[model samples]
Target: MNGVVQNDAWREEYNTLKEQYTELKRLKEEVKKLEKSCFTSSQKQLKKLSTIKKQLSKGTSGQEVTAKEVTEVEESLKKIRETLPQPNNLFLRSIVGSINVTIPNSEDKLVYKERYENFKRNVTIVICILSLLAIWIRGYTRLPEFILQFVSAWFYLALTVREQILIRNGSKISTWWVLHHYFSIAIAGIFLIWPEGECYRNFQMQFLYFTLTISGIMYLQFIYQKGQLYKLRTLGRAHQMDFVQDAGMRSRSMGDLYFLVPFLLYTYVFQLANSYRLYNMYYMQECQTLWQVPILGVLFFIVALGNTWTLALVLVRKYNS
Candidate 1:
């Protein structure tokens, strides 16, 4: 009798689960139908607007009526788009194959954004630690130096993908910030493949020191900038999606400016110095044949110039605002 009772209970639970599954399937179909309907309606609205535009161009009189109609159509179209799912950009579409990257829920988006920021902070710590190890080892054959480059390359690649996702979710990351990572990836790759010899030995310690210094500065910037962002968000001056890692200077105060500018300038100056050293090294009798020297010099110089210019623009914008 107990066995029979257990079998009946199991059957009832299975039936309940089956009913819930059926309801979920029906709800999914309804959502798909709603999406299709919205898209079709938007297409129709666009066609209607195009027709009106052509009619206006053809000199159909009633100019005020035409203008009013155009305004109404555009407003309606905007509303329609607001209701529709945002289409993914080419970069994101290529990787994720049409899956939406936009996190519609505010809390979920905040969690993802914060996670990315935390990841960068942790990676910065790792880079700093490895850089110090590389400096301590003090040799071209050291594993820490090579591992640091590899880690940097991987980190930047990950950053580029994450930033693209963040942008889809309404984060205002600039174009240069994304491109900067690509440049860093290339720089790191160059460092990795750079043959171990006199040329490598010449720059290895300097590179490690530079990495350590920059990582420290970056970690500091992350802390201060994150605090500034929180303050700005509280005061309604900054968006929640705005982050420390973003290239823009949205929430930056004069205090941050004073704190950040000199360090950043020094960082760029170091890059320029590195570029100059690489340039001089290229013409030297021992290093002339190495292809990585000139390419890296050019890359470093480009990044330095871009960064300086971007910083200048931000300062100007901040002052003006």
Candidate 2:
């Protein structure tokens, strides 16, 4: 009898659990339906708000849609967007072929962004160390320089992808920084493929030394700007997604200007100097026949101009704000 009773008890417990599981499954479906409904509703609202904005921009007035109403609706739309998930930007869509990069969980998003920043810093350090070794070994057109070029190309490619991910996750990284990496990739590729000859030998040390110098500058920027970002975040003055840039590309206080601005200007000047040297080398009998010289010179000139213009705009905005 006791064995029969135990069997009956187990059967009853199993039935209870089965019922609970069925209810949980039903609830999950219901939740999914509600989420879809909300998304559809938000889409409709966004369309309506967009129409209202267009009307307002055209100086059209309506009883139901005042300027204040449109503004409020726009704000509501922005908040709704914050709650909803988004996919990668158009640039990433074109290149990386569009997978959602949004991190839904707040804690997970923060952790991922922190990891991204650390990855950049670690790569910078690795490149700096390798550059130093290359310089010390004095292998301008040999294995060391080749290795550095390969590593740099890979680093820039990876960095560009990660920055895209970060941008998708709500980081306010500038377009110029994104383009800068693309340019760097191209330059690195040119360096990787350029034939080793008198022209290569002439420009090799200058290029390596410039890489080391910039790496050092970037390291210092990372150290100082990381602290600045943390402080700004703590004070609720900056977004959590913000990361350090070698040029302090974001609008910030003038305090770091005294320390970082000179270095940034020096970097631009160095690029220009490289460009001029390349220009001069391209005319020399030894380098004149090389196709890489003029191309590299033009690229360096453009990069320098872009960097200076971007920094100037950033500083101007900072001052105005």
lDDT of 2 by residue, 1-321 (tens): 455454788899999999999999999889668756776888898887777788778877464668787788777766555545455567677767765565656687789888888988998998899899988987433788888899999999888888877766667777788888888998888999999788888998899999999989988888877877766777787777776663244436677676788998999999999999999998899987888899889989989999999889878878888
- Give the alpha carbon lDDT tens digit for every residue of 1-321 in model 1: 455454788899999999999999999899878977887889888887887788788877445656777888787786555445667777677767887675657788789988999999999999999998888877445788779999998988888888888776667777888888889989999998998889888887788888998899999888877877777788898878776754226755655578778889999999998899999899887789999999999999999999999999988888888
Backbone clashes, each candidate: 0, 0
Looking at model 1, the pairs that clash are none
- State the C-alpha lDDT per candidate: 0.83, 0.81
Could you give me the TM-score of model 2 versus the true structure? Answer: 0.82
lDDT of 1: 0.83
Give the number of the best model, judged by TM-score. Answer: 1
Let me know the TM-score candidate 1 reaches against the reference structure.
Answer: 0.83
TM per prediction: 0.83, 0.82
